[model samples]
Target chain A: MAGYKRIRVPRNTWNMWLWGWFLVAPTMLGLLILNIIPIFQTLYLSLFKSGAFGRGNQYVGIGNYERLIADAQVWHAVANTLLYTVLVVPLSVALAMIIAVLLNGKVKGTSIFRTIYFIPMIAAPAAVTMVWRWLYNPQFGLINYVLTQLGLDPVRWTTDPQVGLISISLIGIWSIFGYNMVLLLASLQEIPRDFYEASDIDGASKMQQFFIVTVPLVTPTLFFVFVTTIIQSMQVFDVIYMMIDVTNPAYERTVSLVYLFYNNSFRYMDKGYGSAIVVLLLVLIMIITYFQLKAEKKWVNYM
Target chain B: MGIASKAAKAAAYLFLITGAALMIIPLLWMLLTSFKTVAESTSMNPFVFFPSVWRVDNYTRVLNQNHFSAYYVNTFLMMFFRILCSLLFSAMAAYAFARLQFPGRNFLFGIVLFQMMVPTQIFIIPQYLMVDALGMRNSIFALVFPGFVSAFGTFLLRQFFLGLPRELEEASKLDGCNIGQTFLLVMLPLTRSGLVALGIFTALFAYKDMMWPLIINTSAQSATLASALAKIQSAISVNYPELMAASVLAFWPMLLVYIVFQKQFVEGIASSGGKL
Candidate 1:
């Protein structure tokens, strides 16, 4: 056994402190200058009236908010976003949970199945969207091809306003299911084997075992997956952007809040108003997450 | 213990097999379609999984037309530096949070945790403005610099580091090593699993990323493979062959990484999801 002693901070140790701060400083500083500061800048920009090239941003406090409240398009985008969240979160979580449960069985080639499911999770989003676009094509697309084989009329995916959001949401559902499935599967594995063994001893059927044991045990992971899915759906952009042609007639129905933010900031260069919209989106996310957390406590089983 | 029970097990296998097949069909279809000619690709009544006559030219055409080589190099470089920076910063911060009794450590960690909930979307506008102000647009740095710090990575690593047994650090201290030395030698090796977990995630997100690169890198040469894959659409008449070939190439590396490290990767993300 070696003698123990608390090492004193050598004079050079201040250099270590300085170096640690220095190493960590760029990142924290970047986050501040780039992220945190911009958050405030966006808030401030929201208050201002924009001029050409986003220059001469004059202050008109709450004026932008007033305009936004009265703006139907903003509300439409909000509704579209909320609808997307509603569509994606539950669909993603439930489907993922079901698949995870199905996979939790001591089946052969499970790892291969897990890999197959996770392919969409890693594939380039734009590429995946393009493939889906091809599939969604009413003419000569695989989806319509399949539908026609089933003797159904071809559905115009991105072009038709009625089915566009649903079509986009379908892709969203496909892409995210694997990630959630793996999450739930991990949670399901954590469930003590004894729980199932005991349930089986008590004459529980497979379904009952799932309900009484698996469901309760995996609720914590399920809640996590749910909250994250909701949060992700609310902020979703890449799929919608790549899937829906912004110039098409269906744009009105498909434009998400982030897409609208992108349009305002990049396309139109209405930086000030765009900033305002982002701030509002942030506030909305925070409030929604708070509520989700409160709700999770009621149903989530931490053990 | 009867033949009837054996039949039930077989049914379970059948259900799982169908589910697995459904999951793999799109990928298999994409691969098969990539080898088919334009006529075969658009065929309505083509009851063919394999191409009647394979055209290998699509891969060549996509490679020649797009500056794909440059994009691959740039994307990989971005991933390498981004991962390196993220690991270093996150580990250092995590170590401080886990082991050090510094002033305002918890408060600082709280700030990082808060930042995780604030979506990257909200930060993009302000981040973009700053990048524009710095005149770093269309540069690789613009693509990789902002991503160097990850709140989630720091938080996850902190959890892993905290869960580490303190005995190693105590022994190292007895050997007259300082905090930095102990962290470098003892703690770092002990937390290898967490590091690998962080690495896989960093690599996955960094490589698959499109939004930031799309916004930041306007020049084709500087853009990533993910961005390069989008070039398939700009050319008239969907070239399924080359497009699928390119998509396959783009999808292959990460797929290989995941397959190679499936156990660690799955376990890492699963546990991280639970903790975070």
Candidate 2:
């Protein structure tokens, strides 16, 4: 009986193993070919001077990186990308936090407000950019018209290099704050009402309770929103691509890493250099995320 | 409650109402501008709030002059196939990872997480080359290639499957059901909400995806709505009314569906921690 049981256990284990491998085979293969292999392939491609139509290639180890280091346009894109992230992250997070707290309170028509705010998140970014472009039109835009109505100078919304990145950041903040609000609302709901009641009984005002009880508990989600928004803003592409063009004066001021990569890879057919540029973005994101994770223990409260 | 709290509540309402208006004005403007004439749309001095004629012909003109219908069809097809593939493959892999104890399981899941961490552009150039090698560019297959496997879906569904109880599978095994039968007949039916969330996310991502469609299918005949709207923007220099009309057409389907399935959309996004 013991011998028979041992044989049955091994056979069953074998069958389960076969089924497990069979089930996972398709996704594993797809990721290997479509995503994983391509990462290494891109890294390999970055080492060469790619020919037309992906024909003959001359390998130039570190040459693309060398050029990228001295390339002013690449540095400009790096700065612009970082600046866009800086401009978008704090303001959007603060707005989202305030709105989340407001909606989390005893408020009427919370769902209505949520639906309206999230509409921008659902709309296509390309379409959103087109609408904003029309709004930013210098000659007859509603924004400029309103500015003139208020007896203020009509700022060049998209053309002026000085004001261009800020204009794009406004759209960025508008589109994303709702998403951050939703995440914050979710986390806020997780906090126990006992904490609020306790604070209230301690003679804390509404504003005091918010800072003492609400903000500390919501720090985890706040950290998440901050990190994800920074990573996403670093990859700003469609809005900048749609709003500013090569001929626009703000192109240098608004060009992001992904946009520059798109131009290099597709427009100029410099796949190798594009690969190198994207690699730089990947490394930068990893470094930033690593630091965020390390700093989490200092500020993020899991309880 | 008290006087101070009443005043605070009223203040909160005021703040929320103003914020909601600011969020909605751009979309409302898009709808209003779609019906205006060129002169009215571009009118500077007076600022047209509403169209003089409320022309419906802009929609018809955009449809007649461009490949708007083709874009609709392509976008729908892409969304359908992407959702289908993601659900099927992701469910299987997620079940394996969540339930079955297999050798190298941790190592394999690490690969999925690594893929999720990296930016998607790292895969694009080589994906383009692979599609070109297969002569599949400018086709629906090219549009749906990268979505055939989803790291995000796998991770999401694994969490759901892990939440499920193990008793169901144990009972199915005692009833003479094999692993496949237990999964399909017993376990799969229990995770309806998970599947729905994944489906919603896949569809939303597929709809808003511009870069892949733009790069893979360059021609208007095969373009998605997002990319086609981009083409219209670039093709016509200053046709504000027509451009607004195209924007309206491109986004209204999503907005309408969102209105109808508002709860699902909100819960799907909220629960999954999904971003647009």
Candidate 3:
């Protein structure tokens, strides 16, 4: 039996080739047809402008790219997305880190608190945005209701171009705060106790230990949060789409790049422009990802 | 645990309580609004703290009207099938990539990784055209078709498989098992937790999906819960209580799942960042 098994082993390698093909065929075919093919198709389609309805598409080459650069609305969207990322990345991580640190202790209701915090992450973006829209409603929303109770003027949370983007950011922070908190808290628990114990023996205060020992150990997870928050913030669409009503005049200020992509492609039927916009987004994401991967060596402490 | 001082514990409690309250305020307000009268939910000036009389009308109204029943069924059907297919196809491909050697493996793997990085909206326009060409638009199949398998799941599960010791497969090989047998009998079952984690991730992604569902399915008849809610939100307009009620109703399935599988739900998310 052992001799036969040894002889059969030589054939198993060849069999593995067939088995591997069999195993991966479904996903491979799906990826090629749904992902890889369409990816190139989008790129190809970008070079040509679509005609009326389903008529023939015209070759545009770099014409769409030129228009994208000149389009004021597109630039405005890029600026809005970048600015929102700047505002959200820091606050989401910092606020969540504070909450995570507070909850990492051996206290009662930690799980309960953690559960409550993660609810927004669990809910759909539509659900979260809808609720927030009600809260930010000008005349009778909960937020304005609270402001008026404080004897202050009710500010337009989702209106007034000045603060519309800010309103979106606040909602973004609130939604992501719980998610970042839980992830950071889980990573905090993974940290070894020896570092803290050693710091304690050296007479480091609790606050000092947090900065010196805890912070260094958690930097890897922190970097993960940073990359995640940055990428996600740049891609912010569902919330903006759901929250800012078309009638709400503040819509102009809060339009994100993805939102613009949707408009040019679906609403305006400017498929070429939409393709260029997304291709630009794709390149931006790739560059950002490349830099993040390179920069991880500088400060992301694995040990 | 013993290292914590009483004073520090008290401070932690205070901080956590306040933050937790802040975390839940929107959901709490949503729940309250869902139960309030329209006049109470949109009450201005004085602002009603609690409804003078709690009403169940919004729940009944939303469930009975606004095509709520169809939306609920469609969403559940899409979620169930997507989760089932994603797990199966992802695990098969992940096992092959992780364990088997084949020609062009590196190139194929690179494509999977690239798919993982691109923003999903980038896929929408052409995917919509593809679905339209297939004459499947405004159908649940189209809503679930492009996502029939997940590149992320394949990548993540491959990582899980690579972490396993080689001896498990070798030992199975000693029993005259084939590569397929080794994967099924000796390997795949061992990756249950990894599979569960990926399953939860898949479910969450499908549930929260907005743009794809909204764009692909034009009519309410084919709408998933998220798209249905988006439609209802636009159609219902500014009736705060009903909107809140619809929002809360839209959230019930997820809330129920979270409550039941709290640990998996939290860990699936806490699996950390880049889920999109």
Model 3 per-residue lDDT tens digits across residues A181-300: 887898898888887899899999978999998888888778878887888998998888888766768877889999999878887787887999999889888888999888988988
Backbone Cα, N, C clashes tallied per candidate: 0, 0, 0
> Residue-wise lDDT of candidate 1 within B28-96, one digit each (tens)?
777887788777777777545578877777777777877877887888888888888888888877787
- Which candidate's lDDT is highest? 2
**lDDT, candidate 3, B130-236, per-residue tens:** 88888898887987887798898898788778878999998999998988889988899988777888888788888898888888888868888898888888888
Instruction: Residues B11-112, candidate 2: write the lDDT tens digits.
Output: 989999999988888888888999999889987767789998877988999998898878988999999999999999999999999898778789999998
Ranking by TM-score: 2, 3, 1
Instruction: Give the higher-DockQ candidate: 1 or 3.
Output: 3
DockQ of 3: 0.61
Q: Model 2 reaches what TM-score against the true structure?
A: 0.96
Instruction: Tell me each candidate's TM-score.
Output: 0.91, 0.96, 0.94
Worst 10 residues of 3 chain A by lDDT: A4-13
Model 1 lDDT, residue B240, Cα: 65
* Clashing pairs for predicted structure model 1, backbone only: none
Order the candidate numbers by DockQ, best to worst. 2, 3, 1
